[model samples]
Target: MRNALLAISLIAVFAFFLYVAVNPGDFGGNTGDHLIFGEPKYSDMDDYFIHNGQNQTGANNIVTSIVFDYRGFDTLGEASVLFTAVLGVGVALRLLRRDKNDE
Candidate 1:
């Protein structure tokens, strides 16, 4: 009984994946909201960064300007979060190893 239930669940998950792969654009609900694969959704923000990023940030590289100047706080927050996660994992592993050695 357990094996049969597991097989059914696996088949259902596989069918969901296959459906998503076949109709990637059907997620938006509306007919006009379909997104083409591999094409970027261009917005006014993109244009603004491309045209004025250098002038505003004084950085010759557009990517650098956006990361450091336009989104500096966001980037800093992401780095902090990543660092905390790594530290947490290290502490957890060290404690586990110590406990194993004690046993």
Candidate 2:
């Protein structure tokens, strides 16, 4: 019953997002409303990154350039966190299995 409810909830959420993407104006109440959610009013920063990211970072992929060059430290921290979590999980499971075998 819980799984069924979760599946139904997931489907409803996906359908809502699909409807919003297909008919954004319906959710916005206007075709060009920019108060909360609509087309971006300012894209100068994004434009600059796209145009100069390759040359500035010497990376052919703009996304990669931004992630590894502009936000290298942030990405490194996230990777470190993920590695630590996986290591912890592995150690904990190994100790648990060892305890079960000894008992």
Clashing pairs in 2: none
lDDT of 2 by residue, 12-55 (tens): 99999999898766553445535445555766888999999988
Which regions of candidate 2 fall more than 4 Å away from where they truly are?
Answer: 1-41
* Model 2 weakest lDDT span, ten residues long: 27-36
Worst 10 residues of 1 by lDDT: 28-37
Top TM-score model: 1
Regions more than 4 Å wrong, model 1: 1-37
* lDDT (10s digit) by residue, model 1, range 53-80: 9889999999999999999999999999
TM-score, candidate 1, is 0.63
- Model 1, residue 10: C-alpha shift (Å): 16
Score each candidate by Cα lDDT.
0.88, 0.87
